[model samples]
Target: MASTICYCLWFSYVTILHLVSSLAKSDNYIIHMDLSAMPKPFTNYHSWYLSTLSSALDNTDLDTNNLNSASSRLIYTYTNVMNGFSASLSLAELEALKSSAGYISSMPDLPIKLDTTHSPQFLGLNHRTGAWPAAKFGQDVIIGVVDTGLWPESKSFKDDGMTEIPSRWKGQCVNSIGFNSSLCNKKLIGARFFNKGYRAENPNITIVNSARDDTDGHGTHTSSTAAGSRVDGVSFFGYAPGSATGVAPRARVAMYKAVWYDHAVASDVIAAIDSAISDGVDVLSLSLGYDNVPLYEDPVALATFAAMEKGIFVSTSAGNDGPDKPLHNGTPWVTTVAAGTLDRELRGTLKLGNGVSITGLSVYLGNFSSSHFPITFMGLCNNDTELTTKAKGKIVVCENFIYSSILIQEAEAVGAVFISNDSDSSFGHMFPSIIIDSMNGDIVKAYIKKNSDSTASMSFKTTALGTKPAPSVDSYSSRGPSKTCPFVLKPDITAPGTLILAAWPEKLQVDVDNYGNVTLFNSFNIVSGTSMACPHIAGVGALLKGARPDWSPAAIRSAIMTTSDIFDNTGRFIKDVGEGYKRATPLALGAGHVNPNRALFPGLVYDAGVQDYVNLLCALNFTQKNITAITRFSSFNCSSPSLDLNYPSFIAYFHANDSSSRRVQEFQRTVTNVGVGQTTYVARVTPIKGFRVSVIPNKLVFKEKNEKLSYKLRIEDARMTRENEVAFGYLTWRDMKHVVRSPIVATTLKLES
Candidate 1:
């Protein structure tokens, strides 16, 4: 009987495996078409696409006349972003499409991943002063956020002081299950979702029909951080209590739901960008990215180029894989942001039996007895049965911080002490818990080993403001010297991304207390990532747009970069928490932490337009076909290709052995005066080691506000070392009242003999 049961089970497993293999044979792919090469007979691109798809399908019965049957295989038909469509097709079908007319290229649909909250005062944004009043609090500036869905009931979305929706906005509030058009007021002008790709991939799984309702809380948090209205008396479980306001409080918000529960498909993201561009958003904020790929193949990069052509400013997060990793969304057109620390800390104290009190960070609010509990050391606290047996009624110490309080709670432990190497301090633990650095952790572990009755107790959480050496580059923020495009400096700027307080979905529970009760303030939560930092720049971009409606996207980016602050509040050079708290390099902090007030009147700005990007693509050695795929244009010239793309920062690559001969490279840049009338600007270069830098015509005299001036920067390598190394400096163009600074980086590569 047991043998017969085994045979039946084996048969069932084999049948299921065969079924899965059959389903996997057909995969999703994004097909790019050359619009210029479209057959003259086919007037409508949609009908042409249908005919083209039907020709490729194995089933001849699938024709354009049978619209339902033909459309069933299509995922998304992109128009504004790219001339393409995403569909599920077999290898045979893909080959047929390649052989058909107007096909540019095709790539298998890849998965994307999500990569904010902060004090407005930390960024020098105040209601009545500085850039806030000058820009009228970003009045009527529409910020389109493409991420997870949103929570309509959050107080941050209330249209208390908002004006009517902008007449230029052509977006609509899409109604779905749990969400309707009525939820979108003047503050939230539009909400839409693109999930056909996701649904096509996971055919059996059920997803919420509502695109406006956020369940994971990521979208709500990011959207609110960029343009949320002010909500007074906000806190996260009574921690960091204050009025929470987005960087641009009065700017309108429009959400495009592309990221779902786990991951986002590239096709869906492209569709979202297409919709945002067609809907007329002034600024686009995307807090998600995938691995680094070439510009020609990156869907986000391609779509953003189109948005830039339409005069829309794009802000994207540098990926979360940081400390030392290649950054994603490295396109020159978008304002890529890196994560930094805020001046706030959630403080918690851990008291030992020997009277040694160590203060760390936590967001724990559960009550703990004053009496110290017996302490025990667990390597990682990963084994559940062992923990339940040995850690009952005691304080458990862990070597790693990832073990949640639920594990300790399930083990019946009174509290937990996590020792971590990371500087993160935003975790909310249900049980009384605290996270300390590895050095402090050693002290606790040693104390437990020495005494027979070692015990420890944790205090409640407290908020600490004005922490020193803030605005430091976070250890988790991605770094630069982009491998894909080494000529351009990535992560254009850094902003407050750690311990940011913002609106959250009220229904989502953060954590539960000792008695299994939810202890979180449902309306708000603190999150950290490059994701949070991206929206800060997006909000700043909106403020710039509101203040100077005539400024292009590149002008806004240049202003933000040139007028950034390299020094922290303590008047010390900003540091990097990643490299043992060393002075941050341009690769880590970009131009430096963003300063909205200084960015408002940057005196002079470096501006680049669609033609400039086309030239850049040509300089990158991309073929005409590849350029057409990315730019959606049929004709482009590579005759005057130059690596110097007139960017905000300068980066020069050299060989280490070239020291014998002084290798000199020159870069040309043009700046337009945006400040007061008749300004004389002088150039000054911070001397870099092993290099001599000079600027021709060091003095630039602008006769009028709109006058444009050009200059050439020449760098000569003097004493290049044998090892691969990097040197950093700055080129500052200063008038009497304004300083326009750009970072200069020189990298030396070792050559083989």
Candidate 2:
């Protein structure tokens, strides 16, 4: 009874503390001012946005200088995509602005919570690591990366021994704070920034706008991964120590700073895309996006479609909201990339007082004594609890429900152990701690509860190299069956995104430990995300562009997707690390892990031009007016329905009730011969369990290069499963030397029809 009462009191104290903390934060002085209503219909987005902001500021009684600096005071404005402006203003000031004009709803810009090397060989791009590819190293191609910004001073951006800049490049460097024209060398040909939206979104914070200068390491890391110059001895504290080079090391980078402090405003990103397209970049690399929205409503998708029409390839991240999360901005025109793991892992171990040692994972670089110490739970270490002294030098076990780092810090424990719901192989903690799985965590908790002198020892290990069964889909890499466009498969391919070692901005790569110890590295660090994967494919796209100068964006995308390998190094089918180590499906890994060498020589490509995409837009249920607005075409006639987009992969969507259990779906596709002439490829369909799939005119014979052949794919499903059931298969076009593959997925999603 005493224990129960004590537990109740402790829980009550925590609940009250949390409530008080929330109230304290809610009562803070600075307030989030939001302009909710979208302005009246306007043709020009920028003009209307600037005018609305000016009018809002005009209502204020500030001096001329303050009024003129309204852009600086603004946080973020929603112009083209949605509507609204978020800023840091007092309640009265916000109300004044809202009452002024063109304001509806008011809210805060709530803080949204925000891989490389051996990957080259893993993707069969071993030749790119050296000079074997010769002039094919993306020589004249320019890759425009839209992200945080660039770090010009990194050795990877040096223009040493670089050739003359491409004549087609019409870009220039913008001078902002620390950024200068000198940073734009032959290698990094252009640098620009869009921050009006950022400033409008973050008026309370005085952030430096250094043009394309990257304060956070995200932009620098991605840009370097896409086209960094070859640098020897690049690594993060001796880990991954070796020569570091991008897939297209010689590709020129045009930096566009659209993301600010990890959050990108839709208007700012669209502006950046427009500028990049106008600047004549051969390829655009975007490592940022948000939740999935309709393609027509997505500014990024609309801009990218425009870019595709202009012959520039756009590669975007598949997003990090993982396991089975829907992909973001996963339009058919853009190359959506997913994250995959490499052959490297960093492991650590925990020794319990029961003389049992369990392996946990971590990348913590600090060293501690090997002796075991008494352990306790955070509940016992509460402020008024009797375990404060017991937790002083002991390792404390904390539930992963809250931030383990904060709990450990507050517990005053020498070391900490966090109970996680993730897999045992999961390991990303950076402190002197071990994140054990819940099962083992419970065991540790029980051991500690059974005896008052429970203790454990923790130790770190050197980076494990060639850690086998590699090239698996990263669990966090966003999955797809595109929420907006379910007929198309997203994440065109996966790339080495986990534990990737790449360039890091020196200024932002510093870490301070619990002992007031500061650790700094000069060049590179390990990071993981589909953001990392996007650049690998973008760099590959640059290489393909440099080689096949006449290849359309669709042709390049087709080449990469159709040629990607679905197997890992161990000759086993690649696993989706996100889906509990199950065999990866087409939805998890798209076409598979990107294979650069195979892509370079892909015999046949399912090609779709601008008109083809426009035809796809016509298939959607939008009115002709809406379609014209989306495609920027005045007279677009409706084409066939969704599945006939001539995509490299095939997907069939269905939603069947008990009355509509049996259904048939058909798709038409056209493939162009980019390979040797006089090649005959035969189609072979791998049957799905519950569906009958057939391809008409299975033999495709190409008499000459660039010849086109059309075929029909039909899927008949007879089984009635639960609603929204998804099944997968594949179709392979095989020749003597080439095997062009495409995934076939059937989904019982009625809306997809």
On TM-score, the candidate that comes out on top is 1
Clashing residue pairs in all predictions, respectively, total: 1, 14
Instruction: Report the lDDT tens digits of candidate 2 across residue range 385-489.
Output: 443555667887777624446445554677777776343232333467776655556667777888877888888744545455777887788888787777677
Highest-scoring model, lDDT: 1
Query: What are the lDDT figures for the candidates, one per model?
Result: 0.83, 0.74
Report the poorest 10 consecutive residues by lDDT, candidate 2.
24-33
- Candidate 1 global CA lDDT score: 0.83
**How many times do residue backbones clash in model 2?**
14
TM-score, one value per model: 0.79, 0.77
- lDDT by residue (429-515, candidate 1, tens digit) is 566778776756877888899998998877865675656667899998988877667788877999889878888989876533435
The TM-score that candidate 2 achieves is: 0.77
Candidate 1: clashing pairs of residues: 117-500
